[model samples]
Target: MRAVRDFASGIVHEVNNILGVIIGNAHLAKKSSANAEALEKYMGEVRDAAEEGRELMRHVAVLAGEQSSRARPLSLNDLVINVTSELDPPPELDLSSEEATVQLDVWMAREALAGVVQFMAETKAVTSLRVATRVVGSAAALTIEDDGASPTDDELRALFAPFTKLDGRPKVGLQLTSLADLASRSRGYVTAGPREPHGLRIVLTLPVSDGTPSGDRPGVPLSKKGV
Candidate 1:
């Protein structure tokens, strides 16, 4: 299937790119005349690149495993805060929420949310990655938005499909396609689109806790702009 091919392509592309960085650094190290400063610089680059590759592989492996069986009713808003805080993300990250408690495998749900937060953090042009949640009927929608990284309609169509580096940007990374897969396994759905005025937006919908939706609300804190 096209989906399978795309997933394969994405994984290969990202791995190759990281390997390229390591190789380039090795070449520089070989030519550095044994100078401590030059060797240190080259070694540092190699180490950093290798670490990134390691993290990617670890996360990919986590995603590769069977979905977590520990499903429960919990507040997604709280999950976002907990995960992002652990990341020490940019100060510009504005996380808000109304009430959005959904039934999900917390571990897998955390992984999916981490993918979104990590991708946004990597976008140098992004001013801020804003997150919010709202409840409607028996479902809760968590919207993650950015003030940068706008994609074309065509790009948007393939956003959750697979492939890396769309339009010269990290379109997916272990992107939405993986998140979609994880969400589906946990009985949820995810979608993407351009936000109003400009920017990228992703909304993940899941069944609400207790099958009864809470009222809609935005980030209530003025300081961090969180719920």
Candidate 2:
């Protein structure tokens, strides 16, 4: 019941934001019709917001199980490179020199990682970021460390739960909650903790795969812990 509410709430929150952008820009475009450059800019904003809403709905479909997972053999290095390349002012990367492959849905993996990265970069007062990928035991792991405001232990736990309030306002840390869902779907898990001295550390681990049964390949169970 809480999960259902949280899911619905997140969808509502995000949709409302997108709608605000669309509506605001549409109004601006109407008033700026006489000014070619300004009108073009407003219309472009509306188009981009609409496109974002469309993508959000697609992601919701996947979360609701209306879409199916499309797991395939993929190189972890390639996946990291492709996803990070799409982010503006992308994080500083320290990928392992060796190749590590994992079986997972590419879209889910990409979105989950991108969402986390973007959230931290935009809202967490993060000045620098370190994204590293490697093989830990039989799991392909991604560790994202950021020089950002350090959350307390309780705050770290709250990050993975929707609708947690901070500073007397609702925080849409739903990105991490969404991440938990996507990780579970990928047979992986996510953990977050305070980094030494300052900052935050988030680790996401998925089972390493070679198209064989992963029973023998130690997997990262759904749990949270320190880095």
Candidate 3:
């Protein structure tokens, strides 16, 4: 199928990027052997890249239903906070006050969200990003908005289509397609539309476990980091 091929192409692209990191860092490590600090830094980068490649393979396995039994109930709010905090330039968070625990594989969900955020942050046209969450009916919605050049409806559709490449923005198509695939596996859905005036809005909704408010509402702490 075309979808499968697009997914494969995207995976190859991502794997190439990871391998570039590993190879570049390895060479740096070799060259910096005399400088203990530089050598350690390069080695660390190489190790991190290798671990990322390993995780990517695991993600592929999970997507193929080989490791589909690893999901658990987790607080969506907490996961969002934890993952976003680790981003190089963390996005602004306007998270939900209520805790919405959902059944999900942490790695899959984390990678989906992080990949999107990172893509947006790296985009030359995007200026700002805001992430928010809300419990809508039986599902929890994680929405990410960006102040960037708004895509037309046709463009938006292409972004969510698996393997649908975009001009100079193939990564967007790849990331969102992977996200759509993962959401489908969990009985969730992804929606995207042009934001008012300008920019784009994307929402990922997943069913919450029991739909009960388990814990006290957390305080809203704004992260004022530049994107």
TM-score of each: 0.77, 0.72, 0.68
lDDT of 2 at 125: 65
lDDT of 1 by residue, 1-227 (tens): 98788778777888899899999999999899579899999989999999888877776776576766756666777766666665555434444445678876655666677777788767777767777777888888888888675788888777877554556456566657567876787688888888777778888888878743222222322111101
Candidate 1 overall lDDT versus native: 0.71
Q: Which candidate, 1 or 3, would have the higher lDDT against the true structure?
A: 3
Query: In terms of TM-score, how similar is model 2 to the real structure?
Result: 0.72
lDDT of 2 by residue, 88-200 (tens): 67789898776677886666666677777777766546678788999877888888888777777677767777545433222544567667877787788989887877787
Winner on TM-score between 1 and 3 is: 1
lDDT of 1 at 80: 66
**How do all the candidates rank in terms of TM-score, highest first?**
1, 2, 3
Note the Cα lDDT for every prediction shown. 0.71, 0.72, 0.73
Q: In candidate 3, which residue ranges exceed 4 Å CA deviation? A: 8-59, 167-170, 211-227
Q: After best superposition, candidate 1 residue 203: deviation in angstroms?
A: 0.8
lDDT score for candidate 3 against the true structure: 0.73
Minimal lDDT window, size 10, model 2: 218-227
Error of 2 at 44 (Å): 4.6
Point out the worst 10-residue segment of candidate 3 by lDDT: 218-227
Compared with the true structure, what per-residue lDDT tens digits does model 3 show for residues 39-98? 999999999989878867765664565434656676788767766776666688988877
Between the candidate structures 2 and 3, which one is better when assessed by TM-score? 2
lDDT of candidate 2 at residue 96, scale 0 to 100: 74
